[model samples]
Target: MAGSDIKQSLRKLDFPLCARDALYQIEKLCTRPGKQMELQIDLMSEFVFGEIERRRKRNVPAAIQELQLIEVQSDFFQSPGGIPAVRNALFLSLYPAGSPRYKILGNLVSLAITIHNKAVLNAAGIWMQQLGSTSQESVGLARHILNDYFVLTSKSVDRLQQLPILTPHFTANLLTAIGEVYKDKNPPTEVLRLIGEWINDNPSLLLTSLMDNPALPTGGIPMTPITPIAGLFRWCILSPVRTAAEGSTQNEDEQKLYSKIQHLLMDSVLRLKSSGSNKHAISAQHLAATTRALTLVLQSFSNIEPTSRDLAMERLAQAVSSAMSANCIYGNKQELLLLLQSLSYQHFLIEWTLQTYSTKAV
Candidate 1:
């Protein structure tokens, strides 16, 4: 069928048929090699989206199904040229949060991860931002998507390692998404374990990415080097691992993972402290990010035994004191003072609590 005829037919049909025929024609045209074919594909996309909007209130399921089919069956939506339309269609179909079609939205997210295309990853990031505002009915679907995301990325560590080259925004988007999931009161342990394993395998990549504030827009990106720090700190503070029953012991693997992260955090602080030379000056942003990350590291030690936690705190305190003594030529002194004051308050509370318990024992 000619492109014009397909467009006209799509306009006349209702719901699923309009979407189904539009996808079929888009697929067919996408395979052809020419500028004219490209133009035709674009035309079909417009018609498909228009029909989606026209029928959305009347038949959201069909529109959502069309997006899911396109995402699953073809790479067109994953390609750079088609991402915007695909993204728009997906967003438009997500409504009346009570709809049972959220599972399909979750599947679409999984498909995007499977495609591992940068454009699609961005679209998925956008979807996640939208999904956050949805009702409780969507939580299960959101969790499913998070689990799938972790599983997929865990299986593709090498691919993820090369993400900066293959898909520049993938790492950022993935980290942002993980940070979002961690916002929940009880994030899935499986997801957390997978993240720890991935970090264990690629500590440098993950840490450096987390620390480096990319120049991308923050609209859909949730992990901004500083924002996630507080969430992570809260995770450490609330984790049962921090206040296990007396004599409870962590598995050897878990201990090692925690130890590795601790080492990485210290290493990061050392790097930040030693970064500037006479010829160069560290920026305020870098200083703030490094400081916040260090604070998070200290909070994370709450998961360790009391003795280990005390020792880690002592070492961290000394390091912070030394860094402050140097009077690094970056960031406002008042900001640094506030950070130190905050740390001091947390340390005092911990110490006071320990002393009280010791006195009670005596």
Candidate 2:
């Protein structure tokens, strides 16, 4: 086939893996170092730049169409060399460490997984490693896939229970993504097992991270409506802490850690309550995380008879309630109610119940 004819043919496939091998051989021939080689370079550069411009104009899916064009032409470039050349620009566009495109870039990772492109998928994983809270928006389905990939795509969460908490971002993302899987109407069992394993892996990281960064909100707070870890944290908060009440000789280290976590929760809620940027930008994900953490602290101490726990819960409740009041004032009632309802059922009720239980015990 002529060089132009070969290029046209390569531009036709949606996926690279599906193209015929013979076409690849012909494409290599088109690259022989001669007069036509210069023409080939110009043609390829024009195509790539044009694709980039088109993507800029129309949005990412259009960009995906162009990527498909690249895939068809993959034979023209050669696997590692050609594939990355075609992939680099789009990869750059999609995974900026702190860019606004972080969320959409995550969706693109999802699409890459859908196409079974392991190379691109791995690239996405590496990109995520460099991001921080800035990439929380990208932690939905893409997170599940990446987590699975890291765990060798484990069939059961219990099967991979020993994974370490590598980063706060990953920890936050995995927690919420698992929440999503469990919150789904059908409720995938794999998700529960996965979460069970995750909890086993680093039950303390969430608390520790929050204690260290009191400004951090709940995972997937405003970003997602249903977060499993948020629910789990709620469970932890409402449930009594046996270690505290059983006269089990509470470890000082554990106590201090828990106390710091509580302080962080209080701080986050206070930020939300103060009005302005923190409250105005308070997404559901952040609220969920904050509420859950605060609630956990409340529940852990509920087993004790000390007036201190009561005072702490009271202050935390006021902080959250104040935040909600401000949120409602600003007309962000959806999340305001979410926080309120969780507080009403999960945290406040526990305090009330604890009071009654303490009176009876005494």
Candidate 3:
């Protein structure tokens, strides 16, 4: 009878507020001098979050309500592993793998961005990384987000690009989402175009999945000097999406769109590497990363036009020479050496790259 009464009381309580207060009090108690032991703090935290998780399962409607309410409350997600329990519960209940509530995701994502809550964004990013890989819900969510930017059209860069949160915090997860969405079928040109625009906007899109990526866009493609993040541009733009059969209109459009993506990426790399002479403009890491990225992009397409290929290789050689003259080989020489070694297969780069490669550390 008391258990039944507990359920009745839980349904009526302001669980989000109560949970927040509970966390705040626990923090105080744990921090008070001589009030708690070191291990005790962790134990208390786990107990509190564990109970919250259980309560969410027992009353999902209440969990969903808390999910919305917690967003407005300051310091709600501050407690480590404290608030994500509620988030996970709500997502599982509201967005089941089979049948998710699509309409709710936009407002949730948009609100998350509008409020500019770092904790909330981080939680969402990590959550997607964990569950999004196999979940059907993630694929649908990706489509919904992508659709908001570009519709299925062959003509247009004329529309306003309303990409709010383009950070790898969310975009990295899109890798999994993209995989699930187009696992079996050919990639649509519209999607390729949408991502190309994103590459132009997000400079460090590849740096994460680094501890987490830590961007908005106004106009030109900003140079991405950071290595892994620049590599991310290479990964997404050159992703091996399924292609349509040859001679078909679908194949032609997809290839044309993909070529544009490649060019955009190549240009970004070229700009950053060329900037290697301006130590203020680019880093030692820049030339190494960009050189490797361009090589990988070059290798991916066997049929890349000779003119473009030759021009790219020639530009790369100049950039390397310029960067070397600027002493790019001194710093990050270990990393630079590894990258150059990896590119030995690209014999066109073998000339200066093989004989000219030097390390300060050596």
Compared to the true structure, candidate 3 yields what TM-score? 0.42
> All candidates' TM-scores?
0.50, 0.33, 0.42
Instruction: Say what the RMSD of model 1 is.
Output: 10.5
User: lDDT order of candidates, best first?
Assistant: 3, 1, 2
C-alpha displacement of 291 in model 1, angstroms?
A: 13
What lDDT does the true structure give each of the candidates? 0.45, 0.40, 0.46
Clashes of each: 0, 10, 1
Which residue pairs of candidate 2 clash?
Answer: 179-228, 218-289, 220-285, 221-284, 221-285, 221-286, 222-283, 222-284, 222-285, 222-286
Cα lDDT of candidate 3 equals 0.46
Top candidate (TM-score): 1
What value does the lDDT take at residue 263 in candidate 2?
46
Off by over 4 Å in 1: 1-9, 13-74, 80-105, 125-142, 149-168, 183-190, 200-204, 207-241, 245-249, 272-305, 308-362
Model 2 root mean square deviation, Cα atoms:
14.4
Give the lowest summed-lDDT range of ten residues in model 3: 240-249
The residue-by-residue lDDT of candidate 3 on 106-178, one tens digit each, is 4455455445555555545554554543256656666655555455432432332333253455555664465
How would the candidate models be sorted by TM-score, starting from the highest? Answer: 1, 3, 2
Residue 332, candidate 2: alpha-carbon lDDT: 34
Off by over 4 Å in 2: 1-172, 184-190, 203-362
On lDDT, the candidate that comes out on top is: 3
Task: Give one digit per residue, the lDDT tens place, for model 1 in 213-297.
Answer: 3323224343323212222323333333333422355565654444544454344344445555211122334334444654665
Question: What is the overall TM-score of model 2 with all chains considered together?
Answer: 0.33
